[model samples]
Target chain A: MGGDFHWVATEPSGAGRDILPADAVLFGNGRQALYAVLMEGRRRFGWRVCHLPAYICQSVVQAARAADMECRYYRALPAADESPDWPPFQSRHEVLLSANVLGFSGLDLVPPDWPNENRIEDHTHDPWSRAACESRAGYCLVSLRKTLPTPDGGAAWSPLGLPCPSPEALIPGHAAAGQEKLAAMLLKRHYLSGMAVEKEEFRAWQIQSEAAMSIQPTSRPLPVTASMLPHLPWRRWRVERARNAEYLTDRLLGSLTAPALEPDRREVLPPPTPRRFPEQCPFAVVLLCRNRRERDRLREALIQRRVYPPIFWPLPEEAARRHPEAADFAARMLALPCDFRYTPEDLEEAAEVIREFFQTEAG
Target chain B: MGGDFHWVATEPSGAGRDILPADAVLFGNGRQALYAVLMEGRRRFGWRVCHLPAYICQSVVQAARAADMECRYYRALPAADESPDWPPFQSRHEVLLSANVLGFSGLDLVPPDWPNENRIEDHTHDPWSRAACESRAGYCLVSLRKTLPTPDGGAAWSPLGLPCPSPEALIPGHAAAGQEKLAAMLLKRHYLSGMAVEKEEFRAWQIQSEAAMSIQPTSRPLPVTASMLPHLPWRRWRVERARNAEYLTDRLLGSLTAPALEPDRREVLPPPTPRRFPEQCPFAVVLLCRNRRERDRLREALIQRRVYPPIFWPLPEEAARRHPEAADFAARMLALPCDFRYTPEDLEEAAEVIREFFQTEAG
Candidate 1:
C-alpha cells in the first residue's frame, strides 16, 4: 500500500463558491428545501391548502404537512387516462405542487397559466424533468443525495425570482451521516491501495448510517456536500442515463404492460421527446408489469443474477388503502438500476435478465 | 488573554458515553424526537388522529403533522373548570398527546389509567415533570437545549417499553452548527481570560449561528452535543431552577392569571409535589399576565433592560383561528430565563423589573 486515499469532497467543484443568485439555497433533504418554499408562501401570502398529484411519495406529503398546508390531490400520472385536471381553485389554496414523478415518465408539465406563485415543483424523482431546473413555480426542489454519492443534501431555488433562504449550518448527527459516507469511500480507497480493509465493518457502518438518515431530523446539507454537488459532471451523467434509459426502453418496447390485471401490453412505443435539458438525468429505467404477480416474479428473477432494482416506493399502506390506483401503480411499477453506476454492458445484462423472466413466465 | 479557551464539549461531563436503554434516544430537538415517536405510533399502531391541548406551540402541532396525524384539541389548560376531558376516541385514534405546558406550571399528570399506550407526554417545558424520566406512557419528550449550554439536544423515552430507533449519523449542517457554538464558547473564554473581545463580531456569529440552527434540518444530537449534554451538572441545574421557581412563586403568588383577557387568576396555588426525580429541570421561570396588554408591556420593559424572555409561542394562524383558547393563551403567557446561567441576584433583578412595570402601569 502506498498511502491513505483522501476522501473529503465528492465533486471537487467547490460548489459553495459557485456564484449563484440569492434565489438558490441548500437544505438537509429535498423535502426540507421544498418545505421551506411552502413555509415561506404560507407565512407571507396566507396560503393554507395546496394541490398535489395523487401519484406521489410520502416525503412530498409530509413536507406540505411540515409547512402546515392542507393537501388536495389532482391526477397527474400518465396511468390515469384523463385530461390532466387541476383541483378547483380556491382562495385558501395557496400552492399547487407539480411533481416530476419519474424522470422520463409521468404526466406532462402543468400549464404555465396555473398560478406560478402557488407552485412548488417537486423534482425529487426526476431532476431532469422540464420543471426540474427552470421552475416556472415559486420553488424548484431537487433531492440530489440519491443521485450523488454525498450523504445528505437537496437544493431549492425560486423560479419566480424570490430570494431563497440562506444555507443552514450542520449539527452533529448530520455531519456523522456524511462522515460515514466519507469513511466508506476511504475504506474502498484503502483496499485499492493494497491495504487490508475490513469490508464487513464498512458494511455495518453503511447499514447504520442508512438507518440513521431515515429518522434523523431534517437539516441543511453538510458544507462538504454543498461543494461536492455542483462539481459533479451532471451533464455527462444525465446524458449517459438518458442513453441507457433509451436503450432499455427500446429493448422492452411492445413488451411492457400498463399496470393492470388484464395484461394490456403497450404494443406501440410513445414518440421519444427531445431532451431539452442537456444534462438529462434519469433516476431509473422504469418498467410496468402486467400485474402484481408478474412484477414479483420479474423482481425475483432479476435479484437471483445479482441484479437489484429499486422499488421507488412500497406505497405506504395508508396511501394504498386510500387510493387504490396508487396501490395498483405501486404493485406494477418496477425501476431498473440505470444510474450512472451502470455501463452499456450492465444495461444489456439487466435487460436480458428481464427478457428471460417474461419468456419463462409466459411459457 | 492569558490563554486560548479550549472550547469543544458544552457539558464538561463527556455526555455521549452515558449508557441509555433501548427505550430512550436523543435527537436534535425535542419536537423532532417527539415527532419520531408519533411516526412510530402512526406506523405501528394505526394512530391517525390525536387530541392535543389547544394551548400549545406550533412545534407540537407540526410534529404531529409531520407524522401525518390529524389533530383534535381537548381542553387541557385551566380554562375549563372540570377535570380535563379526553376527546371522544375512535378506533382510528392511535394516541393522545399530553403536554406539560410551562416548565414550572401547567396541568397535572393525566389520569394514570388514561390508556398508557395511547399517550405521548411532551415534557418540553418541564423535563422535571414526573413523566420526564420513567415515561409512564408510550413517549416522553424533553427539549434540553434551553437548559444547558449544549448547542442542541432533546430526549424522548418510552417507559411503556416501546422500542426506540437507532441513533442516526450527523450530516454537515449540524456539525457546522455545533462548530459555530464551539467558536462562541472560545470567544467567551477569551473574554473571561481578560482579553479585548470583538463583541460585535461575536454577536454576528451568534446571530448567524442561530439562523443556521433554525434552517438546519433536525437530526440526532451531534457526537459533540450528545457527549457534552451528559457531562452537564443536570442535577445541580435542576435544583437551582426549582429553587428559582419557588422564590419567584413566593414573591408573586397571587399575581398570575389563567392566561386570559378576562382574568381567571387562581387565588389558591396548587400544593407542590415533592421532587422524586431529584434532578428537576425547569426550562424557564414562567409568569402569567393578567391580560395581553400587561404581558406585552412587561415583555417590552424587560427587553429594554437587555433581559430577554421567551414568548413561549406565537400561535399559528391555523391553530389560533381554530382554537381561540390557544390564541388567548399565547397572548398572556411570558417566560423569564431562569436557567443555570442566571444567579439568585439576577432573578431578584428580573422580579424587580416586573414589579416596577406593573406598579408604573397602575400608577
Candidate 2:
C-alpha cells in the first residue's frame, strides 16, 4: 500500500521538465487545512475572515467561531453571466476564503478586484489543481481525502510564501497513526458500507490523537511523505463523475433546473491535459426548485426513498432579512450527487425517480 | 432475529403478564434517553433534577443546561470497611434518574425515603428488570437500542395514573425507519469494531431521517408498532455481565475497591433478576483515582492502547470551583467496563493490563 500510486499533476510524457518550485507545504486533511489557514490568518495576520455561502457545512462556521473570527456570508454568483453586488471589504486586512463550490464553479468566479490582505483557496471539493491563479496574498489549501484514495492527507501551498513547520515539531508516531486510521476508514468505506457514516467520528478521534502526539519545540521542515501521495486513478474517477453528472442532468432537466455553467471558459490546467474536464470532473448538479416548500418536500421525499440530497444551509434569520435575494436562492437550491461513487445508471434511475415525483404532482 | 430469546423479570408475572408494563419508560438511545430525562427535566419540572457526581461525559451537563436545569453533585459516601464510595446516591432529587450505573449500584441506592415524584430511572445502563422498579416516578425511560437488537426503540411508562397513548396514535412507518437505523448502527458497532468510532455522521444522518419520519400531526396519538418488542437474551446477558464484573473486581480488590452491596437485600425475579444488589450485578467496576489529573492521564493511556475506560463526568468550571469536594470526587473516579460483550477471559486480560499499569508506576 505504501508505494502503490503516486499523484502526478499530469502524467509524465518525456517532453517537459517540472516547472513549479517547492514552497513550504503544510500537509493536512481537508478541514484541517481549512482551519490551518483560518488560524494562521487570525493569529499571524490579524485578518477578519468572511466565508462564501451555501458551500459547506455548519462545522466550518463553528470552526470560524472557535477561532473567534466573525463569519460573513456571500452568495455564489450565477456562472459568468451574473455578478453579485459584492459587499464592500470592511477592512484591508481581511481574509477571503474562496471555497471550491461543488468542485466546478470556483475557477471561473475568482473575484478579480477583491482587496484583501490574504486569500485562502479551499480545494476540498477538487484538489487536482489550484483554482485561484494569483492574489494579493495567495495560499491554496487542498484536502486529499475528498477526491483521492489516501485516507488522510491535506496540503497548503503558497506561491507567495509558506510558514512550514518542521517535522521535528510534529507529534511522535503521528504519521503512522494517521496512516493506520486512514487505512481503517478507507477499508470501512469500501468494504463495509454500513460503517461509512462513522468516518467523521474516526476522523475526530484521529484529530485528537494527532493533537496529543504533536511534539513541542520543533524545527525540521516536514516533507510530504510518499505515503501521503498515493496513485489516484484521476482519469478513471473523472470520466465516471462526468458521465454520472451528465446523465443525472439530462434526466432532471425536465422538472428541475440545473445550475448554469459557462461554456466559454476552459478549465485551468497545464498543456496536453492528461485529465479531460468534459470526461472527468463534473462535481455536482445544483438544482433549482419552485420554492423553499417545494425544495423541502422534494428533500423529504428523496430521504424516504433512502436518497439523501444535500441540505440547505439555513442562513441566520438576520442575514436572510437583510439579503432577501440570497435567502431566496438558498431556499431554491438543492445539490444533487455527481461524484465518482455513483454510476450513470444510478444517475438515470435517480433522475427517473425525480421526474415521476414531479409528473405525479403536476397531473 | 426477533424470536431467538426469552424475556424475564425479577418479580412474579402479574396482570400485564403478556406485555411488561413499564412505569414511565425513557425512550431513545442511551445518550438521548439520558438527555431527554435529565436535560429535558427542567422544562417539565423545574429544580427537581439532581444528578449523581460519579457519571461519565460532559454531554450530560450540556443536556442539563439545554433543559434549563442545574446539576447538583453529591459525594459517593463509602460504606463501612470500603475505601471508595459505593452506590453513590449522596444527594436526593424530586425527580431522580436511576442510571443503571454499570448494572449494579443503581437498584440498591434508591433511598428508602425517596419521594414518589423523585424517581425517573434511566434503564440505559442495566435495563434489566428490578432497575425499573427502583424508579417510582410517574414516567420512566428505556433506551431500547442498548439492550435489545432493535435499531431504535424507546418507551416512556408511568407507574402513577396517567394516560398512555394508544398504539393507533404512533406516526406511520416511524418505528420501521427507527429500527432500520438502529439495526444499521448496531451492525456497524458489532462487525466494524474500531470503525464504530467513525459512525457519527451515519448516526447523525439516521437521527435527521428519524426525526423527519416521526413527525405526526398533533390531532391524534401515533400508533405504536407491535414488532418493536423482540425477545432479548436477558438471562444470558445478565450472567455474562455478572461474570465479567466479578472477574475484574477480584483482580482490582487490593488496588481499587468495587461499589458495595448488601447481600441480604437481593430481590427475586421471573428468571433473571433485573434488580440486583451490588453483589448480583457487579460488572461495571468504578474506582476512585488520586485526582482528576491521574484519572485523565489513565484515560488517555488506556485510549492509546485502544482501550476506553469511562471517566467521571466533567464538572463545569464554575461548579467545580463552587463545590470543591464534589469536584475532587469527580476528578478521582473512573469506570471499568463490565458489559456482556466481554467474557471472563477478556475481563481478566483488561484487569491484568490495568494492574500492570499501576504496579509499574508504583515500582
lDDT winner: 1
Give the runs in model 2 whose Cα sits over 4 Å from its true position: A1-124, A129-138, A142-155, A159-240, A249-280, A285-336, A340-346, A353-363, B1-102, B105-125, B131-157, B162-240, B249-280, B286-335, B340-346, B353-363
True contacts kept of each: 0.00, 0.00
Every candidate's DockQ is 0.01, 0.01
Lowest lDDT 10-residue stretch of candidate 2 chain A:
A1-10
Candidate 1: tens digits of C-alpha lDDT, residues B10-63:
313433333233446878767778777777787788889877887777777777
TM-score of chain A of 2: 0.66
Task: Work out the TM-score per prediction.
Answer: 0.46, 0.42
Candidate 2 CAPRI level: incorrect
Residue A110, model 2: lDDT of 56
